[model samples]
Target chain A: MLTILLQHTVFGIVTGSILLLATIGFSMIYTTKRFLCISHGELLTIGAYTTYIFHVFLGWNLLYSGVIGVVITSLVGLAIARGLYEPMERHGPLVLLFTSVGVTFCLHGILEFIAGPSIRSFRTPILPSIRVGGIPLITMNEIVIISIAMGSIVFLHVVLTRTRIGKAFRAMASNVDLAMARGIDTARISMFVWIYASAMAAVAGILLALVTSVNPDLGWTQILIILAAAILGGLGSIYGVMIGAILLGVVMDVGVIFFPSGYRAAIAFALMIIVLLVKPKGIFGGE
Target chain B: MFRRTRIVRRVLVVGLSLALLAGLSVGVARAEEVRFGVLTSLSGPLGTEGKPCFETIQWTVEEINKFGGPLGMPIKLFVADTATDVERGITGARKLITMDRVINIIGPSSSIVVAIMKFCADNEVPIISHWSGSTRLTTSGGEYQFRTCPDDYFEGEVAARFMWDEGFRKAAVITLDTEDTISISDALKKRFAAMGGEVVVDEMVVGGQTTYRTAARKVLAKRPDVLFPAIDLDTLKIVYRELYEMGITFTVVLASNAVQQATMDIVGADILEGVYGEKPANALGSPGYAIFEQKYREHMEDGMVGWFTPNMYDAVNLMALAVEVAGEATGKGISENIRKVANSPGIKVYSYAEGLAHLLRGHEINYEGASGSCDFDEFGNVLGYARIQQAKGGQWVDIKFYSSEDLAEAIR
Candidate 1:
């Protein structure tokens, strides 16, 4: 029982970290943009597929492709914001909302067209498992995930709290008109936010690929977990999103040790619903 | 804004015209060309399976065309990617049947087979599934749906029987959460329990889940004598690796068809050593398999390794045979003729080339394919024998054969 509990916790934390990466970006985008970026999953797919292409196909170093994939996908996000989202910004938020969905469908089709519809596995490096006192520790990929997730949270915290542009970004998120009145360039802040959120999503996608195999639709599936986490963390609160992500991950994985594995996904969705009923604002929302 | 509106109008007009042109072409195009739709997850996680099916079908179509088509008419292969989406499966099937006007459809491999089977049966379109092995496909009332691969029930029963023969009593089942998997696991559990074999634990894993430690720990806690994990290749490899790392060992680990050569390749030999299960016979085991394997390896750049590739190759050939035997590519005629060509006795059709020759020489060709014999029962299912193999010395060594009859008895 002790071993099982510990194992479950360890595994849960690894999953939580990946979920945190996805949700943090999702939460940030939602907070500033004020609408669901349905194409966020495609951003993840871009990151994963980019990593697969760069690292696996071109035989580039894993670490190099990991960084490059994140960078490329961040650029993709910026492009989408400027080219697709910006056009509809003057129309209405709803127009941008529907356009995001259209972008998602189009991206999905384009990926299918290029990748030739086959599963591609990355030539994953064999990292040794850390063991202590006879208990095997998780893989280095998982440890990297936990570290990156923590790093992201801390970095975001510093950026939001200390930086001038970060304050302007926050002001814009709270009220675009008010921020513009205060001489903050709302458009610039929106672009920065889009780049930042997408960069985070790319990092998350790369980390997910590191831990698991990369596929075109990987981002679409991971987005569900991210959505659950972000919703549980009150949608827009970065700190809350992180905590909610960990909690959602734990509940879905660790909470259902005895249950059949199929129920794991169902549990994640069920937790979101249950939390929504009890604490609609989420655990960290009151802050 | 005016320019944008102009572009939108042009797109609408062009889209409408294309639709109209396609509709008109459908009426004018003669029914001489044998049209078959290959529906599989060509663009999603399961696209690996779909890719080979497409390639095999295309390759078969090319060969048939070179020989002057199925019945002196060129074969037209219409391919669609379902991406493993259930809804997309239906849409692809409908398009293949209604728009493409294909007499037969060959896939979106696996569960998509069962999904499209009902629709095909209703519409009277003969669907020869290349990979999916759902019980629903062969259970009953699926006259139009034909499967070339061994059924899932056969897989489970074969796995269970192998364990039973090995004298394993207590078993734990770890299967995927999907309905297709759960049903097969349930069937295995019921069968194992009926044999007085104790199923100490039954666990499920969601598809696309990366980590398996929690479930592995829980399953290990049960301490069953044997672990019967029925899942896809990707998930199975992850679980096996986790179990190895955790230092967990059972007297036996029984896997289904998913734990074949490709899976064994991923996790390496050390983890899979001594793991026993029922899967399609290795391509090395049969002369027909060797010939196809050699040709595929030589000619194709992106060909799939192991079982399903040849199975799909045979399925495409079987479709052509069905068409030839029926004397026309009508759904009703083709579906009925499948059994006639598949189970024809004393007929020696080793490959598509051979099958084409036999067709020309006025002989019924029994497709003893690379995957297995394409012998369909009254249920339109071929009960192919599952090969029992153990991972040893970095390779799968076939120990013996577990016939479908043995499975039917042992599972019950």
Candidate 2:
């Protein structure tokens, strides 16, 4: 019984790690840019597919291809922010939100057209997994996933709290008009946030593709839980999103022990709803 | 003048109603050229399988046309690309039945076949398929619905019997939560239990998820004697990879759904070795298949046929033979005579020409085509042949072949 519990928790952590990285960007953009970028998930798809193109099609090394994939994905996200969202900034939240939805469809269609509908994976040598005392806890790829998730959380913490740009970003989130009047250059900062967060999500995508299979719907499938994680941790709360992601992951994974696997997604949302009912401002109570 | 106007108005009303009645039902087979609907995917995900299935069926039509095209009228194939999708398939099927006026139609892939079935049933059009393998299509096999391939239900039985024969006493089943997998699992559970094997664990995980580790562990905790995974072909390899990571010791026998090259290639070689499963392949020992192979090679280089191409070839030939047997080019005519021409208790004919000749001479003809004996039971599915394939080295090795009857005998 103890082994089974540990095993499920391990699975949950791995799931939460992926969700953390994917949702971090979503929460960051919401805090600074002040609108839910619905197409944010497609950046994850673009990342994995671009890596696939480099590694599988171009025959580059997986590591180098992953770097290139991340770079390319960040650039695409930057372009989307600058090209689409920035220009429509004055048009109110509703217009920008609908535009993001349109952007989601366009990006999805483009990915479907280019990559086609088949599931693909990188050609990598399979290594034996690390098992302890008859319980299979982790694999090498999963280790990489957990490590990256932790690293990104720490990285985001330092960049937002400790760095000078962090203070400016906080100022913008607190009062955009006052921050701009105080010479913070809010527009460049918003674009910077998109690029950095998109790069982080792309890293998550490559790790995701390595551990699991990569398909056209790779990111779209995870977007719902990502939204739940963001909301559960308090929408637009960076640190809160991290905690929410891991907790939801563990809950869904362990929940399988009690409920059927079909209710995995439902488990995450149920926790979010419960948390919201208890504290309407969410766990961290983001402004 | 008033009397003349009233006469004109009455004539116009009668003429308009007659035209409207004719427009309600689409064109059936016409004089000079007979229209037949080929509803297969020309593009999209299943297009890889769909395109080849369509080509082989198209080639068979061309071959039959050389010999006067089934009842002295040239067969005109009105092709509709389903794009390997259900919505497109439904729309394309509608166009074929209501617009193009085809006598009979070969519908799209498995899921699409289920979707457009009611529409075709309502319109009263006969469907011949090589792609659809879901058992749902055949449960209460109605008129105007028939497939020239084995359905998932029989494949499920084969898995159960195979597991039983392999000395597996305790069976665990993990499958996708789709209707097709349900059909396979339902049959497998019934048959395996009837054979005195205990199903210790049964899990139906949802598709499109990243991992099924929790579900896998839940099934593994039971420590069953064997595992039967009716998972989605894409997810199957991923699950096996996870199980291997977790130190899998039990044996796994897969359903025929996982028997494809694309899957094996992505999953890699040697990973699935000793994993035994059944796949519907050509009847290598049958002369009917041998001759079909020879002709196929003559047309294309390498002459490789995909999974259901032979069954599709048999489907078209059966349609032609049935058309000749019925002596009319209507859906009713073909549906009534389909079983008569394909089933036994008649002289077995291999080629379309041979079947046509036999039918023309007032002789009952049974089609023994590229697929094994093209026999349709009351369920309207052919008793197709399947080869038991075990993954070895980097390729699927054929251990042995089993006919539908052979499988039934073993189950008995």
> How closely does chain A match the true chain A in each prediction, as TM-score?
0.94, 0.96
Q: Write model 1 residue lDDT over A12-107, tens digit each, in one string.
A: 888888888888777877888777788998887788888878886798997898789888998999998989888777887688789988998899
**Fnat (0 to 1) per candidate:** 0.40, 0.40
Residue-by-residue lDDT tens digits, candidate 2, B1-412? 9999999999999999988877554333266677789998665545546666777877888998899887788889999887666788888999999888888888577777788877887777788888577868766564878887777766777777788888999998998876556777787898899899999998888876667887788677889889988776667757778887887778888776666666666676667778887677666667788778887877655477677777888888888888888777777888899988888889988888788888878898877878778788676776667776788887778887667778776433
Q: Residue A271 of candidate 2: its Cα lDDT?
A: 95
lDDT of 2 by residue, A164-269 (tens): 8888888888888999999998877887799987997798788777777777777877778888999999887888889989999999988888887779899998
- Segments in model 2 whose C-alpha atoms lie over 4 Å from true places: A162-164, B1-51, B61-104, B107-111, B298-303, B320-333, B344-347, B356-364, B409-412
**lDDT values, one for every candidate:** 0.75, 0.80
Task: Rate residue A153 of model 1 by lDDT.
Answer: 81
Give the docking tier of candidate 1: acceptable
